[model samples]
Every structure is written in structure tokens, then in C-alpha cells.
Target: MTDKSTSAPSSDSVSHRVADTSPESDRGEQPETIHEDRLWCDGGWTARVIKNEDDDGWAVEMIKDGEPEPALVGPWTMGRNKKDPKPLDVSAFNTLVKTASEVLRRHEQQLRAQLHKRVAVDAATGDGQWEITLDIVPDDDEPYALLTAIDAFGEQLAQVQVAASFKLSKASAASWVENGFRRPG
Candidate 1:
């Protein structure tokens, strides 16, 4: 969800921040280009339009700035934010806003997940540290398997994806890995 409200977040005053950081901001490198007039969550993110040198459409880039790479590229536009603005409406601004917002949101989500320790499984190999219990029932031609990796206390460590046509074993899998798995001939 993108909020295009006129109210800017206190932390995200684009004018002030842009002035503080970009050296070219003062020289008017970062001008207030108009478009759908789209602003999200008080400029937390905004899309900016750029002119496409090759085509008739416009190039829209989402400027995150908060992330390592501030400029995130998006699809080009046809008209200026869909409608006519009072002046030379650069629709890229709105596009930038939306794109930047999405990037930020995903970044924040990843951060939160990393910080919280919900599930932890040791992905180490072959000390007999974990046990894999696979029950293959081949009756009535209904072949199936319940693949589970469990700890010492019967607690599930991880669920492994098993194929319905189970034909591979650990030794074979290891050999395949070591051999770089070429065509069978």
C-alpha cells in the first residue's frame, strides 16, 4: 500500500534531506517534477520520471535513497502520470515514489525477520547429528513417502521435499553431486 498524502513524515522530508545530502540538489539537480502528483507515506518513497532518449515513452525510476542503491529502475511511461499537469509534468516522480516505497517495505520486512529468531536448524552434514525418517508405502500402486529430519528429541528440524517417484539415495545423491551429474549413458 502506498500513501500519497500531502503530509510528509517527519523523518522523510524530501526537500530537507535532499538538500542535506545531494550536492547537486542545490544546483537544482533534484527538481520537483510533477506527474500523478503521487507521493507515498509523506515522501517515504516517490517515483520520478525521466525522459526516454530512444522511445516516445518516458523512463520512470524509483528513488529509494535509504537503501544502498537509491535509484531503482521501473517500467517506462506513456504520458505524464496519465493526465496533464499544470506544467511540464514528469510522471516519473510518481513511479519513483511507488517503486521506492516497495523496496523499502521489503527491506524492512527482511530486517525484522532476521532480527527475530523464530526457527533455527543446523544445516551441517554427516556426523549422524540429524535423523531422516522416510516411510515409503508402495501398496495398490500408491507410492508415497514422509520425509522428515528430526533432532534427538523427536523434534522436527526441517522438512525435506521428496519426489513422488523416489529413486535416489544418499550415496547416489552424494555421487551425483561429486560427479557434477552428467547425462546418463
Candidate 2:
């Protein structure tokens, strides 16, 4: 048996029960709470327009998934009368995602090039080529570099320690290879 008396719901209770109760929501579907002015782009990226804290203008921020900070943040276009921000659209969101992804990709490539530099030089043995690699280990206490040489058969020919400041340009690498991979005087 149940009580027959009806009671009014409290304001807090009503607000708590106003959650998204759609079937899609229960099924763990994609997020649907995004307003038309904000978007969750594909590839784990999100773009949002917000009021600029520094001024009375607007700004856009592009954040990647699981990141605490935005990868890209820039000014947003103003609407008519220059008070409101222009609404975000599909075209603009896609473009921002592309640009942000490119920025990340180029940053990674540049870091790789800096930490590990490589050059191919003609082997003085007159048989096969040799590969010269300089790997920089930037330790906080003692930074150093590992200069290595490998023959065509992937056998390590020589390795030595050099200053982390050593620059591995094409001309410098060629000289090293010609000089038998020894520490330059």
C-alpha cells in the first residue's frame, strides 16, 4: 500500500530532475549541450567563444581533449554594433580545428628536429654510405650530446660525447664524417 497524498516538488528538487532525460542522453551519446555559439569539433577538439577578460571584446579558444589549457586562443569577430561576438558556425569551427592541429603538428616536428638531428654522408671507405646522428640530451644539471655514426649495414661505427651546443649542419656533419668521427679539435 502507498500513501495517496500528493505533495509539491521543491525548487531544488525540480532543478535536479531537469537533467537531459532523452534516450540519446541515457545511451551515452555525443554531447548535445553545446550551444549554437560553441562546438565540439571532431578529433577531440573544442572551440568556444567567450568574453575577453582583459577588455570588452570577445575571444575564441581552441582546446584539445584532456588538455588543461587551450592550444590556440585568439580574438573573435564582433557582431553588428561591435558589442556582441559573432556566432560560431560550422565553416569557422572546421577552419579553426585545422589551423590548431597544424600548429601542434609543426611544433612536434620542430622539437623532434632539435632533439635528434641526422645527416647522411658519403663513407670515406668508398664502399657504402654512413649516417651521422646527433642526439641532444638537455638535462637540467648537465646537458650533453651523443654524436654517433652508423654504416650502411646499420652497424655502429663510432660514438662520442660532445658539447650540447654542437651544431649539426650539413657542412659540419660532412667534415665530421670525413675526419673519422673523432672529436673535432
Candidate 3:
């Protein structure tokens, strides 16, 4: 029999072999599973244990598939010997994926909040309250916003394009309604 240590295939080779036989390969998709001492790739995320720049300790970075940057990075535990990092495991990798997914979710929520605004004001016509919303489009060439007015029944009354810098507030919405939905100056 051959010596296992000397004849063992590298993780990269093993990964390719696994992918070649996987169903995804039939459709030209890359294999998404990898388990290594310092690296774990699965479930649309990859967790890598790396050396910390500020200290002698270790850090783990979680990167979503197709993303250029890691979504989360934090300290990692040391192994029993204290000189080497703790080997990555299934549980630890799953936890890292959860935390990284949460980070991405919060980031998306914050971005949506920044780009959308809403205010409710009494209609100048004395008909009823109207919900005014501003949705900003952050285009590189022509950044703008769409100001919309909706009645209490959820029917849209008006929509106008405005500068992206337009501020949405109760007073401003009231002014717009009072001006008969004319484009805000």
C-alpha cells in the first residue's frame, strides 16, 4: 500500500474531483462545498481563518459568494497549543455565516431607509390626509427622486420627478399639496 501522507491529494485537487462528479457540473456550475482546517466554503458563503494584523491572534472573515469583500471579520480562538488557530468546523462556519448574513441584511435596510422617505399631511383641499413619499434614484449621471402622493385609500394621486436632494417633511408635503401638486421648486 502507498503511504497515505505522501500520496494524499491536496484539498484543491479533492475539491475539483468532487465538483467534477457533482450534478452542478453537468450544468456548468461550480461546486459549492469545501471543508478545510482553515477554510470553509458552502451555503453561498466562505469562511476563512487568517492571521490578525494587529496581534498574534487569529481572525475569521466571512465572504458571500460573488462579493469582492468580506461581510464580517472577527477574532478567532486559539487551538489547544495556543500557537496555531483553532481549525474551522461546521458549527463555527455556520455561526459565521449567520452573523455575516445579518450584517448584509442590516446594511440593505439602512440603504433603503436612506433612499426612501414618507410623510403624512392634511390635504390642502380639506379632503383627507395624504401620504407623500420620496424615492431617490442614485444614478451616476442623473440622480433624481420621484415624489408621489397617495390618498388614504392607497390610490396614487400624483407623481413628479424632483432633484434627489429634495427633502421630504410634513411641512414640505403640505406645501406641495397646497400648490396643487406642482413640482417643488
Candidate 4:
């Protein structure tokens, strides 16, 4: 019952979509499923996730808002087995949210990896060791990373860039730390 402009796919350009796919990849994003749930968004396009009613096939709807629409509607596959949808609990919801967030993060990572490059380093020698993976910062040539090194007894060691891919092994890293982390020529 929502407007079409807010729920349908734009027709400005052509796109390619596959008919069959692995179960997890669908996420209720089928052409028909898009139309059923009143799945409307912002750009005069809406998608609906059809709910199972009376044992009927799943479906979706995608139409523009407020235009006596029905521009795009089709059949869709069920996302989860109604026979066992795993009861929705606070813990389950929390876990679902966490998983969803991680999925988004991985997607973002893939995008970044496509645009950036990385290198792995493992510098080690007896009595000294360092290990780190470094990143070649995009648009810049400086190599930065999280560096970890320890002297034999696991003494407090120099640490940095834990959030990045910077790595260095023992010998050189120890020397660098001992020398106050001077940029190596």
C-alpha cells in the first residue's frame, strides 16, 4: 500500500541477474520476493518479501510509490524454513545483529581490498623476533602496520598499528625498537 517511487528498481539502466544461486546469497532478494513485502525504499522503487500464506510459493514485489502500481511482482524462495525458523530471542537477535554487522564489515573489506594492496612480513632471528603484516596505504607509498616483537623472555615489546597490517619479525624489529624506531633506510 506504500508509494511506488519509494520501492521499485530504477529503469534507467540495464542490469544482469542470475536465476539460480546458493541459498545464503538470496537473503530474500529475489525478483518476486522484492515485490511482496511492500519493500519500498527511497528511489521510486519498492521491494516486498512475500510471506508464506496457505502454503503458497514465496514472492516479492517491486513497484513505484503512489501510482496505482504493480509494475514488478514475482515469485521468490523462502529464506528460512518455517518448519524451524529458530525461535527469536534476545540472544538470537543479538547474535543475528552481530552476524549482520560482520557481513557488512566483510563486504566493506572486500571493497577496500579491491582498491588497496597488502604485504606480509615475518622478520625473525635467534634471541630476537618480530612479525607483522603491512599495508601500502592507498594513494600513498608509506608502509604502515601493527608490529610485535619480543626478546627471549617475552619481555614487554614495542607494539604499534594493531589495527593495520604492519608486521616485523624479531632481529630487525628488535634492533629498530632498541634504536628508538628510527625509519629504516
Candidate 5:
């Protein structure tokens, strides 16, 4: 018996597949937009209603184009028959897009907060407050952090490259400022 999963999709099922529209494609034509009962692709996002492996219920996943993972996945409502998933509609798709976009935005904000930090330290000379900031570059080959000191006039006093593991705390910033903004050992 032929394996249904490995067999070529029938002509009727071809409509559900997204066409190749990448720069390397010979046609270089944009795929026809899809708006089916269980799938949608528009606004650079796709919402798909799928079977939930954890349970008999249904689930929906929203994927942004070019991203390998789904941005959002959650329980899906049941249809009137209670056996099939509720059909995807324009309103539902738009709402899913908004929620998935928000998820991505929040992730970016959290990452930024983790990689960037700031603190204010008083100079020993009592000149003014020094704004000290730490910006981390998370490169895979060579990770590092930049420690910067900015004077009250917003002029950069010094910047030094430090280990990515450098911890920027109040005491550390103060010690660095006391040491004349030298690279921390």
C-alpha cells in the first residue's frame, strides 16, 4: 500500500500549499494568498489551526514569514459539531497577528533590557554625575561588553572593552570611575 503521507498531494489539495516566490525562484511570482477554513496567510503572517498533540482538542499557531518557529500557539475553539476546529476567519486571523506581534515585541524588549544596563556614579572630584552604561555584544564567535562613562555634559569620557560576563553593579561602576575609567581587571 502506498503511504498517504509520502504520496504527492492530489490536485484539490494543491490549493493549500504556498507557492515559491523567493528570489531564486524561476517564476519569481508571488504566491496566491490563502484564506481557508484552517489556514491563513497574509500581512507577512500565517495562522494555522492544527491538532493538539497533548489532547483531543485543537490548537492554533501563528507564524511570521521567514521565521522557523511559531510566534504564538494557544487553544483553539471547537466548531458547532464539537469534533472539528472552528474555521479561521478574517477577524480571528487579525487578532492572532496582533497577539503574535506583541509576543515578538515583548521578547525584543526583554532581550534589550538584559543586554544593556545603566547606572550613575558621582565623580571623586565632585565635578558632576557620571553616567555609566554597559552594552553587551552577544556575538557567537567572540562575545564582549563595552563599558562607557559619559560626563554630565553628555560627552563620552572613556569606553573600554570588557568580558561579556562583566557584571555592572553600583559598586563596580563606582570602582571603575575611581580607577579613572580604566579597564576592569
Candidate 6:
């Protein structure tokens, strides 16, 4: 005698997703597809040729994965007809990707340097060196900067709040350290 009411569902009875056969299913990114006006899913990047909003000229936008906005947007070359954009090719695609990547890299570096500026200055007490840093906090309501000094021993010498847009120059940092990390009047 069998008691069907007490039996639990077997693994085979539970619904399961079938194995994906697409080549990109394993990489977890969309596969590359090319079109006359758009190129996407190629190496985690996408480039599209669009009509310029400001004029009749064409423009190209290169976007990286998971980003809402394009990383690079600039004028695209026109074709012989002079009204349509030149078709995107492999060599052109590679070049565009490289240039866009460089632009992103440089922009990130510049931003990082701006947000966290640092300078080494002579310690106020002696010949020993101290590192001064100005970290900007761009708060929505009230933005500010934290001027900090660290000794060679990695000890916090002093910290003060200054304007968010404060520029940390070598001379200014030296002067600040000499003045006991106080906000210059």
C-alpha cells in the first residue's frame, strides 16, 4: 500500500531553467551585434551613430556596460554622400574603443587627484616630513574640505575644516602646517 499524501515532490517534478546555448551565456554579458548605425555586445562596449541634436552632422556615442550615459560622445565622420555617417568597421571600432578608454582613464585620474589632494611638507617642529592632504566632501546641502596632516610615523598631527573648494598648494600646505593646521584667515 502507498501513501501518496505523505510523499514530497521529487527533483524532477520541480521546474528548472534549461541550459542556455548562446555563446555569451557563460560570460554573463550580451554578445556583440553589429548594425549600420549601432554596434553592441562587443567586448563589453557599445557604439552608436546618432544624429547630432545641435546640427545635421552625425555623432557617435560610446557606452560601457552598466552605465546609463555614454562615456564618450563626439562628431562622427560622414560618408561620400555627405549626409550619412560612414559605416562602422572593425578597425574603426577598435580605435574608438581605445580613445574612449583613454578618455575615461584620464578623467578618472584627474577627478581622483582633485578630490584627494596631497603634498609633502617640512614638519613644523623639525626637519622631519609630514604629509598634508585636503579631502573634499561635496555634500548636497553643505560642502566642506578636511585638511589633515600626518607625520612620518603615520600619526595624525591635526585636522581642520575648510571650504570645499580649497586648493591645496605646496606653499599653502606648508604654511598651514606651520600655522598648526588652523584655517588661514
Give the per-residue lDDT of model 1 (tens digit) for 33-110: 323323322244445445456765545556554545554664453433453221213344544465666777888787
Ranking by lDDT: 5, 3, 6, 2, 1, 4
Q: Pick the candidate with the highest lDDT.
A: 5
lDDT digits (tens) for residues 96-172 of candidate 5: 99999999999999999999999999966699788899999999999999999998999898999999999999899
lDDT of 6 by residue, 87-111 (tens): 6666777888999999999998998
Better of 2 and 3 by lDDT: 3
Q: Which stretches of candidate 1 lie over 4 Å from their true place?
A: 1-46, 51-57, 65-68, 80-99, 119-185
Give me the overall lDDT of model 6.
Answer: 0.76
Weakest lDDT window of 10 consecutive positions for candidate 3 = 9-18
Clash count, one per candidate: 14, 0, 0, 46, 0, 1
Which is the winner by TM-score between candidate 1 and candidate 5?
5
Global lDDT of model 1: 0.44
Itemize residue pairs with steric clashes in candidate 2.
none
Model 4, span 50-115: residue lDDT tens: 544646565554444464754444455532443211222233323433544465568678877654
| TM-score of each prediction | 0.29, 0.65, 0.86, 0.26, 0.83, 0.67
Kindly give the stretch of ten consecutive residues in candidate 1 with the minimal lDDT sum.
Answer: 11-20
Tell me how far the alpha carbon of residue 65 in candidate 6 is from the true structure, in angstroms, after superposition. Answer: 2.4
Tens-place lDDT digits, model 2, residues 1-185: 01113223223221111245678668865334343443434446778777799999888899887779988999999865466666666688788888888888998899888899998888888876889899999899999999998999999999989999999877887788778788965
**Model 3 spans with C-alpha error above 4 angstroms:** 1-23, 27-30, 125-127
